[model samples]
Target: MSASQALGGPSRCGWVLGPSLDKIIKNVAWRKHSQLVAACKSALDKLDSVVDDPVDPASCTPLYGLSTSDTDFVLQPLIMALDSASPKVVEPALDCSFRLFSLGLIRCEIDTPTPTPSPSPSPNPSSHSHIFRLIDSVCKCGALGDEAIELAVLRVLLSAIRSPYVLVRGDCLVHIVRSCYNVYLGGMNGTNQICAKSVLAQMMIIVFTRVEENSMMVDFKTVSVAELLEFTDRNLNEGSSIQIAQNFLNEIVDVKSKEGIAESKLCLQLEYDNSEKKGEPIDGEPGEGADLSGYSKIREDGFMLFKNLCKLSMKFSSQEHGDDNILLRGKVLSLELLKVIMDNAGPIWRSNERSSVVKSVDTSVNLDNKEDAASDDLCISKPRRSTRIVIPPKRLDSYLWAGRKSREQGKS
Candidate 1:
């Protein structure tokens, strides 16, 4: 008889732990074991047939009347295989994530349908949280076939911005900002790419817009300062971590204030244009500049926005440790931003360095305000450059600081 008939119907884990099924499950486990490698390689062929569409009603036609938890039960093991390092495991994992994302099962997927709410109170709970988490892990893998992971990550960030519920929506925007700070400050353990100044500028523009939307609807009493600080302490170390939280808070405040948001947006757009025109060959400044006020402002704004997020989570009316809650956002964004700052900052910083020095050199030489030949000779005229790239906010500074830090890393 089949195992289901013989063993008192299908057990919760499905399939009996006999030699054949055990062999199947054991082979797919991701643990780095020398002994099981060859067997797992062969079992990969069966992954699609077994677990590819556990949630798809058409695929599992026999279980049309099955409960949601049962459907998840059948699919969870398949995804668990995704966490494994085996090539076989990664393929199915990525496949599942991609499929889930496409099906509107991920936050990025559902987020598109959600329009920006007015400065109003509204709620829209996603039908499924597992899908969100699954998509999240897949996007975090740092690599994807053909498509860049950054684009995938960006889509996720954008989705959060578009969510309808105040707490949930703010949570998403908060993450984008956290990523921004990570990119700006060198906190991501040298894993992320630093953006071009142009990218950074555009990011600020996006963030400034969202902060205003979120700030208007916020119930500031949701999470208190003490609880937020505790949460921050539990999840993040000081260094760039706490600082990122602070920047987010400031950005929210800036966005809410018409005068503040407007000025920052214009300046951000200008900087973005300049960076794009400058291109990818930023070599480095000849001498250290006296100030870091610009970078600091971005950080401070980021922290403030994040602080408010923390407040919301702790004090939410029915909050019960929703992982997607704003207070939990810092960790997610922190790690994401850290990766960008590590990868993209150096070349960008170098490209701008020469220009900054040349400008300084020109200013110093032309004390008489003459269109002098010497200063003119020193400053080579270059054509204006334009790139269509728009960076998400806080992301720019996160990487910029990383680039600068990497430059000085040798000295330290």
Candidate 2:
């Protein structure tokens, strides 16, 4: 029998899936955990035949044709299932949801056309809206702490990044970046906050390292450092923007360190004499003399991103005043970020340049101290000077003299 016929015809396919979903919702509402698990399994099995393992693409027609209400009805229970404590229920629900998502059958929202006097009112929402919804759902689901669920969420995100639809891919990238910024800024809480932090780190590693691989099929055009910074600045407050700028700088330093290690290994491999293994395929060995050329673009983009971040942090450090916790944290993170960047990208910004940046940062910190002292005249008899100064090695004289020169210039 054809797939639709096997599910009692396309018209009745919803019927086959609906009862199980309804039971899931009912059991969940009643707190009947065992029954809810069973219902979820049954729903997943039906979904597999109809959506996941259809005889052909046409077999999913019934699902695609579901009315907006019916579609919402089907999705509601699955979303609820994602919140269940039981892994059995959460796993099946996630699978069913991902299947529906991949097949473009999930309509995240229904758009009702407003009656317009004009001939052309705008286009309906893009079909890819479902991808965003799916991501949001998976990331916010309570079961995200589960290792399996976390992996599934990461897989969904990476797959979306590789989507053939340019709109879908670009939107997904922007959504992930925005979500990361939101989490960092404390705009999100609970499971969503945790999921965003974990996913962003993993996604950064993948995008910076393996995204250009032809085997991965990820469109490299969607990953732009400038666009990332733009989105981050748009989404974050001034203080949070500085914090995220430092965060990106740290990530770049990390990737550059890894690349440096890989290059060192490649050099050692090339120097080793392997004449005894004449017939061996030298390139086949994993990480042995592998091509590093693909990463050159990433490295250049990373350096450009680093330069922009430095400028941003410096701007904020010079402009922002007071001892606000967020601002203080941003300053600390920026200092650490500069240290890491100097360690990793020292060739690009020389040792003397590093000392200059440090000196500039130290001056900003002291300015903050003077402002703090001025505010508390009743609590203190005299304006205190910071005894401890941060000085980079072999550059004590420059840092000390630069700070004194700046102070004398301000006094004069």
Best by lDDT: 2
TM-score of each prediction: 0.28, 0.34
lDDT of 2 by residue, 34-59 (tens): 65555455554444444332343222
* Candidate 2: residue 310 lDDT (0-100): 47
Indicate the residue-level lDDT of 29 in model 1: 43
Which regions of candidate 2 are displaced past 4 Å?
1-70, 83-88, 100-131, 142-145, 169-173, 178-412
lDDT of 1 by residue, 76-118 (tens): 4434544444544444445434333222222211211235543
Report model 2's TM-score to 2 decimal places. Answer: 0.34
